[model samples]
Target: MQEDVLIEKIKKGHKQALRLVIEKYKHTVYQVVFGVLRDEKEAEDVAQETFIKMVDALPSYQQKGFKTWLSRIAFRTALDAKRKKQRQREALTEYAPSKEASKSAEDEWLQEEKSRAVTASIAKMPETYKGVVYAYYIEGKSYAAIASEHRLEEKTIEMRLYRARKWMKQHWKEDDF
Candidate 1:
């Protein structure tokens, strides 16, 4: 019956009519998105997303100003895309440590967890094993050094550390480390 408007044609069947709508408004959509995004590739991408959004929103659209409504969709879609890009960029940009590299939150957390687990596990050892395990593993002392510190023979230090390892293997889960 020729409502004779682009939006009217689009609302009726929407396949080929949507194509006409896009062809008519593509430049406006691109400009609206580009005004906010300032990147040609991203603007183009957002313009496409904006069209899909417009078609989805067309059912809810009363016959108000079509161009204003369409531009608003383009603007909002661009901003949403921009915010998403910023978050992704922020996520990717981090972890590129500077020359004076420092530990990341994840690394620091894992180190602390490992240290605590080892210390707590060692604390559960018998008195005879506790000193040797702490000195050999936590303090990074050699068998001879631990023996000298404890005034025991080197073989005694080795035996105690071996026994401590066996105890830990039995008592702790495989993933404790």
Candidate 2:
């Protein structure tokens, strides 16, 4: 079967073929973004972006190493999104916090504060280490899948996750969790 056949069908808006393509590439795209963003929700967002780009560019997609090309696009898009988010966060952090806040022993407020603190700690972690933790724990991605997506050995992914968890434990108390 010619590659263009699938491409043409997809470009012409054939839902079945489009769905097939999505199924084929969805995990790959999700793994790529998850390896970078270290957040399941953010990875899902980037995966959607990847699919959108694939659909929009389908008509002009070249036949050379299609999967690699798709992977490259997914990788770049995720990194760009991460950089943009980091910049926005830094800008927001520049704002001074209010000094006088009401005391709150309420469960909702305590929970919210704890969530914020955990998020902050995760954000502080080095990107590579954080990626492993998010992929394994939060995304519930397997070590083997992560290793394959990243072209690394499974042991490496395991070690990264192990160290990341240790770092989190050392830096954050159980109460913070």
Candidate 3:
């Protein structure tokens, strides 16, 4: 069957056509995903996710280059998976100590207490600076990203964060955080 006919059939909710499309483009999808994610297991998983996404995305299938569209989906899926994995690794390392960190039990306890103190300090901040502080520090967002999300300028975010940190410092002792 021709690619166009198979796509039309998939868009019209024909399950068999969806299977055929998957079978036909499976190799291409796997290659694209694998190119982005070096791990074979993750590549396979992302390739499956790409096919699932392709089914939902087929309803918007007005483009002429079906292969290109599918490859784009595969590539994006792989990248998203890679980013998620990276974020997970970062989260794991953010709290736990490593040999290079050399933090002792006393230091770990102090760090936990400091974290709690910082949370309390943030809670006491004025509403204007509170949201930006949480987004930047806790959520790990860049100033530009926080600004875009709140529809404010990046400089405004920077100023607010700076003021918030100053407020925290003045309100608490030096060893608070």
Alpha carbon lDDT of each predicted model: 0.86, 0.82, 0.89
Error of 1 at 2 (Å): 7.8
Top lDDT hit: 3
Best-performing candidate as measured by TM-score: 3
> Please, what are the lDDT tens digits per residue for candidate 3 over residues 1-177?
998888888787899998898898999999998998889998998999999998888888886899999999999999999999999999998978777479789988987898888778888889999899989998899989999999999999999999988887777787566
Error of 3 at 4 (Å): 1.5
Enumerate clash totals for all models, in the order shown: 0, 0, 0
TM-score: model 1 vs. ground truth = 0.52
- Tens digit of lDDT per residue, candidate 2, span 7-88? 6788888888777777878899899989999999999999899888888877677788778878888998899999999999
Name the runs in model 2 displaced over 4 angstroms.
Answer: 1-3, 97-177
Tens digits of lDDT, candidate 1, 60-165: 9988778899999999999999999999899877856664368788888998999998899889889999999888778888988888888999988888888888
Which ten residues in a row are the worst by lDDT in model 2? 96-105
What is the overall TM-score of model 3 with all chains considered together? Answer: 0.55
TM-score of 2: 0.52
Per-residue error for 81 in candidate 2, Å, reads: 1.4
